[model samples]
Every structure is written in C-alpha cells, then in structure tokens.
Target: MRIGELAQRCGTTTRALRYYESLGLLTARRSANGQREYDESDLRLVAQIRSLTDIGFALEDTRPFVECLRTGHASGDACPASVAVYRRKLAELEEFIGRLTAARDRVRAQLDDAERRSRPCKR
Candidate 1:
C-alpha cells in the first residue's frame, strides 16, 4: 500500500508516518514510481508503535519494541530490550500510584477532620 493508505489503515496521519520514518523507527521504501510504499509488515510495525504509545510509552521508548518486531519476534515485547522497557515503565507507574494513594489518604483525613469540627456540639 501507499503512505496514505497505511496511515488510514493505522488510523494515524501521514505526517506522523513521516515522523516515524524520520525517527528511524520505520524505513521509507520507495516504489519504482518514486512514491512511498509499505507492506503488511509495515502495518504491523505501526500497530506496535501505536499500541505502546497508547499505553503511555514514550515515542523513543517504543524503539526497542519496534526493533524487536523488525527482528521477526512474534511479539514486540519478546526481546530483552523491550522487557527492560516494560520493567522501567512498571516501576514508574508503581511510584506514581504510591504517591497518588498517599495524597488521596491525606485528603481523606483532612476532609474527615473538617467534617468532625463542623458537627454540632453535644450538650
């Protein structure tokens, strides 16, 4: 397929496809007519990148996953590098969750104290 078709199929923009090419995440293959061409494998690659980014992975962070796909892995997370990225992302999410939980607890405590103070006093 052509670039436009690939973008449509991936539900992405042609500009984003070009950006991916520029980032070396995708190879810009040209047909004999000098137009960009892509095969099913390219579609798979874009899908991999999209899925990763949708889950909060940075564009740069998706490189290892893309490379894994390019290396013929059945899944993008099938390589050591991709696994390392997963581990790092998991740790980051865990830390953020902990902070959020603590903040939530503090807010709950404040609300409880305020409510108690606002209650009418017993005789």
Candidate 2:
C-alpha cells in the first residue's frame, strides 16, 4: 500500500507515518516511481508503535522493541532490559497520576470555597 493508504488504515496521518519512518519505528520501500510502499507487516508494526507511543514510550525507548519485533522475537517483555524500562515507565506514570490527583483536589477545594463565599449570607 501507499503512504496515504497505510496512514488511513492506521487511523493516523501520512506525516506521522513519515515521522515514524524517520524514527526507525517503521520502514517502507520506494517504488520505481519514488512513492513509498508498505506491506501487511508494516501495518502491524505501525499498530504496535501507535499503542506503545500512546502509553508514553518515547521513540528511542520504542526502538528496541520495534527491532526485536522485526527480528522475530517471541516477546518484547522477555528481555530483562525491556522489562526494567517498562517498570520505570510505570513508576513515572504512577508519580504523575499522584501529582495530578493532588492538584485536582486542591483546585476542587478552591472552587468549593469560592462557591461558599459567593452565596448570600443566611440569617
């Protein structure tokens, strides 16, 4: 398939596909006419890349997994280093959630206080 078709199938833009190629997360062959062509395997790779990226994996972080996948590794998690990377990512996500939760609670309390102050005084 062409770049546009691949992007449409993956629910992404052609620019994103080109970016993925630049990041080494995806690959395509140039046709004689100079257009990029992709195969079914590339589609699957794009899906995996999209999922990992959505979960906050940096392009560099995802590179090893993508290489492992391309080389027919049984599982990306089977590598000890990859496991450690995921653990670190999980820890970071937890810490971010905690901070966001605290900020949200503080904002909610401020909103409640403002609401109380805006009400008319009761007898």
Candidate 3:
C-alpha cells in the first residue's frame, strides 16, 4: 500500500510515519513513481510502536522492538534488546509509583492531622 493507506491502517498520520523513518525506526520502499510503499510487515511494526508508546514507552525506546520485528522475530519482545528496554521501563514505572505512593501517604497524614486539630474544643 501507499503511505496514506499505511497510515490509515495504522491509525496514524503520514507525517508521523515520515518522522519514524527519519528516526530510523521505520523505512519505506520507493515505488517506480518515487512514492513511498509499505507492506504488511510495516503494519506490524507500526502496531508494535503504537502499542508500546500508548503504554508509556518512549518513541526512542520502541527502536529495539521495531528492530526485533525487522530481524524476523515472531514477537518484538522475543529479542534481548527489547527485553532490556522492557525491564528498564518497568523499573522506571516502579520508582515513579513508589514516589507517588509516598506523596499520597504524606498528604493523607496532613489531612488527618488538620481534621483532628480543627475539631471543637472540649470543656
């Protein structure tokens, strides 16, 4: 298919596809007319990229997954490089979760203390 068709099928814009190409994460073949062309494998690559980015992975981080697919892996995460990216992303998320949890606990404690101090004075 053409660039437009590939973008439409991938639920993205042609501009984004071009950006991916510029980043070396995606490549398109040139037709005899010099228009960009894509295949079903390109569709899978875009899907993998979209899925990862939707779940908080950076665009650059999706490179390994794309490369894995390009290398003929049945699943992008089948490669060690992709797995390493997954591990790093997971660790980053865990650290963020821990910090958020601590902030939440601190806020809860402050609210409780304020409520307790605002009560009416006893005789």
| Best-matching candidate per TM-score | 3
RMSD of each: 1.2, 2.8, 0.9
lDDT of each: 0.96, 0.85, 0.97
Clash totals, every prediction: 0, 0, 0
TM-score attained by model 2: 0.73
Return model 2's CA RMSD, one decimal: 2.8
- For model 2, residues 1-123, the per-residue Cα lDDT tens digits are 999999999999999999999877888999999999999888777877788889889877776666766777666555666777788889999999999999999999999999999999999
Ranking by lDDT: 3, 1, 2
lDDT of 1 by residue, 24-109 (tens): 99997899999999999999899999999999999999999999999999899999999999999999999999999999999999
User: Candidate 1: where is the Cα deviation over 4 Å?
Assistant: none
lDDT of 3 by residue, 1-123 (tens): 999999999999999999999999899999999999999999999999999999999899999999999999999999999999999999999999999999999999999999999999999
**Winning candidate number (lDDT):** 3
- Which lDDT value does model 1 have at 13? 99
Better of 1 and 2 by TM-score: 1
Q: Give the local distance difference test score of model 2.
A: 0.85
